[model samples]
Target: MAANESADGSLRAPEDFRSSTCGDTKSLKKSHLACRGAVAIAAISLITAIILSSILFAIWGAAREEDPTFQNKQTENLQQCQKQCEDLKMMLHLATQDSRCRLCPEGWLWWRRHCYFFSVGLQENRRWKESAEFCQEHNSSLVEIKDDAEMDFLQGVMCNATKFPFLWVGLTDSQQEGRWLWLSGKDIQDHLPLVVQWDSDDRDCADLRGDGTLFAADCEEYGPWACKRES
Candidate 1:
């Protein structure tokens, strides 16, 4: 008979006693007021806690739901920053190192103290051996990627070129079957620390892709090749 409904649709019992003598009535009224005050404070605190928690959860959820385009833009920015850093390091190197340090020849790219020239606009693309000969004519050799940095650079640059998909490097297994060699006549395994991850273990020629990966190609594929020299 002394129940009350709270705003949250919960039933609660009033702390006031109905059966009280006149002398005890004032004390009961005082107790009732104190209990009501405590209940009000508790209700306000619970509602405040729920509101704060809801806001925090909404913020966390939105943070986790990142926009795909925004993520792509962030990736592009990171790549550009990396490229700028590399360029700065190259400038400092040219400033501090031997005077012989210089810009790559026309149509060439400079990376890690090496000059790379990607062949293009030829009357016709040459065979693997002829491509090597072309590099030899320039006092360089068909490019041999030496590290991950070099691989990434070559892949990125090629991706921007008008002509691409595959390009040649100074790698072959001509003299002996299954034993690879660089154009420099050194055993491929001995000269390069990384393994030649061939598309198949049976092919001889080496080709680089715009995606910065390697695959074995037919020795006579008509495509541009890269040349490399010390800078």
Candidate 2:
């Protein structure tokens, strides 16, 4: 009976050792599961952080694009540059025009793209036809009053150059009665301001009075004259 009892006690001791081994295995498994869970949480946190960062960056870029002050500043800079370029071009054009105007003849005067010569101190006065011939000899023609601007220039130049009473121009009604014509074949009534004083008869040539008006006169009348040509 004592031997049998000892064997039973040894068998019970083996069962207790198996139970302890099982408990250790269970604890190791639980620790492994907890470690796996922590790793998964870290991975999820990293992914979420990356997503949030990307979202913030996109919002910042959008805000910058919508900034009105920044856009307006860029536009203002562009407009200022354009205006400066236009001013430079205008300056160049004016310089070129001035240079061209300086190429007029020494004894002539430059006005509005034409060179004018007023017969100021001629030894002898010329008749209307003789004045026309004289101007033609000089590679020009008798002055033809065109627009108000040219008339103004002629008056100003004549007043400054000479004290002559009347100057013969290229206006005449000799071609047809009562129909005035310029030397260029253009009708005077069509091209120029009709500030002419007509006579009843025996008047075919035109003369510019000191008052800046035209007067019909005889072709044989002698007076100082003006000539005009391209500059």
Candidate 3:
């Protein structure tokens, strides 16, 4: 009749059995609570670790950016890039100003990497030495014809400038009696002797006629002259 009694009618203590069952339930509850507590602690530790790692990373990044050496290096790189850009712009401007591949300046003729300027009036004309000095003042020298193409160009430009028989140029045999040399101290060896149409008599200076012919003449002759320099 007791709640703890079995079918065989053996004597049983209901309070002691109830107490034992309650003890087992308490053990189960404690195990469940311990498991939940351990899981919560693990979750909290992981979150703390993540937050600490993020803080450390942020600190390191900020410190690195604020470092004097790093900042100086970045500034130096930026300045170097700006300097290179400025150099490029200057080079472009100079190239536009020079370089016979492009147009020549006002009142100057461009031909094969050289710029030619002809004196306009009789007052502007000078003797061979004076003309050489004039060209040197402009940072150039009296014109030197290296080949037939150059000769033709010189003659064409001179023809447009004047109809004179002999236009003074850079060639002269003053240094040696027979050997002609340019004002730049270069020998006139490239042009053949037959190509040089000097007068039968010997003279110190040379000139380019309107017909693209070269003739030996007096060095003191006053006339218009051409100046030449690289692009």
> 39, model 2: CA deviation in Å?
86
lDDT of 2 by residue, 80-159 (tens): 54555555555545544442224344456778777776765532566788779867765679998778888888877767
TM-score of 3: 0.50
Give the per-residue lDDT of model 1 (tens digit) for 4-105.
223564322122311111134345446545555555554555555556556555554565457656545555555655555555555444443432222444
What C-alpha lDDT do the candidate models reach, one value each?
Answer: 0.61, 0.66, 0.60
What are the per-model C-alpha RMSD values against the true structure? Answer: 36.9, 49.5, 46.9
The TM-score leader among the candidates is 2
Worst 10 residues of 2 by lDDT: 1-10
Candidate 3 has its poorest 10 consecutive residues by lDDT at 16-25
Over 4 Å off, model 1? 1-102, 190-203
Q: Worst 10-residue stretch by lDDT in candidate 1? A: 13-22
**Clash numbers, per candidate:** 0, 0, 0
Q: Tell me model 1's lDDT, rounded to 2 decimals.
A: 0.61
